[model samples]
Target: MVDSAIITDNSEVLLHFDLKLEDGSAADSTRVHNKPAKLVMGDGSLTPNFESCLRGLKAGDKKTFTLPPDDAFGMPNPDNIHHMERSKFNLDAPAEVGMIIGFTQPGGMEIPGIIRAVAGDSVTVDFNHPLAGETVVFSVEILKVK
Candidate 1:
């Protein structure tokens, strides 16, 4: 019996990963929360470039790859920034800069948007990903592949 499997286009991969920003600051890490990430290859959740980097990796494999903004989260799009009336925000908890709030889409899906500015009756919300426009370092330790 084979003791291990390599990550393929349809493999289910379980791994611990560290995402670091261009400034060398830790952006996210599965090890920090002690929870490994699980994903099926070819799933739309990961960019094709990211999937390609993991191809053929097996359990116990360790790899680190740098992805530019386009390959990672893509650059921030101006269209993703929106300005809304201040009344739309909850009065109980006033919206402030750097606050992330969930906004429901037309399809009932919720997406997180960060408050960028609040001026009078106008509030600016950025829907771009937090790491958008930034290059990132992805360090992964493959735990299991099936």
Candidate 2:
């Protein structure tokens, strides 16, 4: 058998990944668009639970598995949902339900918040990740492991 470099805690990896919901709807894919992504194994870019699954995998390896909410993006936090004043939004911009808006934080970082409802002066915006609370299937191909 040919020996290969295995993924380790500090390994730098390049990989292609496809993310899908439990119902088979596609969420994201590096193979479908853009070049393979690079990451250091211990970087917080991926959840620890998710990175654990990649341990020991080598280049040219392909893997697919389902991850529960806690293992994936984790359950949505209610605190992530906030009620905003309608006046804070641009009147020209369509503040319709389901639309994602960029909100600037006090720290000057911008985050996306999806509008859930518009009632009177209140606009319900959910800042949780879109995939939060979902069980997802991940398909990954390890292109390079250093």
Candidate 3:
């Protein structure tokens, strides 16, 4: 039998993975959508800690690992939550809690913000990633490691 190639710093990887929360709710999953993710090792595509987990694994290897909040999406930052004026939103659009709106920054980059609350003229918008501060279970099946 031929030995399979191991994942290394230069590997171009194609894999299926899932990110689930402690409550057993899936945050993201490639298998659910019938798609696989591709990435080159040592790239910023995966966090340093996350990339390390894939290192040394070979094709066809399946593994599950848990990441702390910091290692995953990271702890939520209070600064990411902003209080905006109600007039800032377009009048045609409904401004309600739990609504995700795309906000254009000074650099013209569109960033998504979730409405946390609407009180009179003040609308609290959280710019933090939806998975921020969430510890996640990451499971992966390495389909190819070239």
Q: Which candidate number has the best lDDT?
A: 1
Q: Rank the candidates by lDDT, best first.
A: 1, 2, 3
lDDT of 2 by residue, 99-123 (tens): 9989889999999999999999899
| TM-score of every candidate relative to the true structure | 0.95, 0.93, 0.91
Model 3 per-residue lDDT tens digits across residues 1-146: 55498999979999999999999998899998799999999889998888988999988899999999898889989999999999888877767999999999999999999999999999999999898999899999999888
Select the stronger candidate by TM-score from 1 and 2: 1
Badly placed stretches (over 4 Å) of model 1 are none
Residue-level lDDT of model 1, residues 70-93, one tens digit each, is: 999999999999999999998775
Question: What are the lDDT scores of the predictions, listed in order?
Answer: 0.92, 0.92, 0.91
TM-score comparison, 1 vs 3, better candidate = 1
TM-score attained by model 1: 0.95
Q: Is candidate 1 or candidate 2 better by lDDT?
A: 1
Residue pairs of candidate 1 with colliding backbone atoms: none
As a whole number from 0 to 100, the lDDT of residue 87 in candidate 3 is 89
Off by over 4 Å in 3: 1-3
Candidate 1 at 57: error in angstroms?
0.8
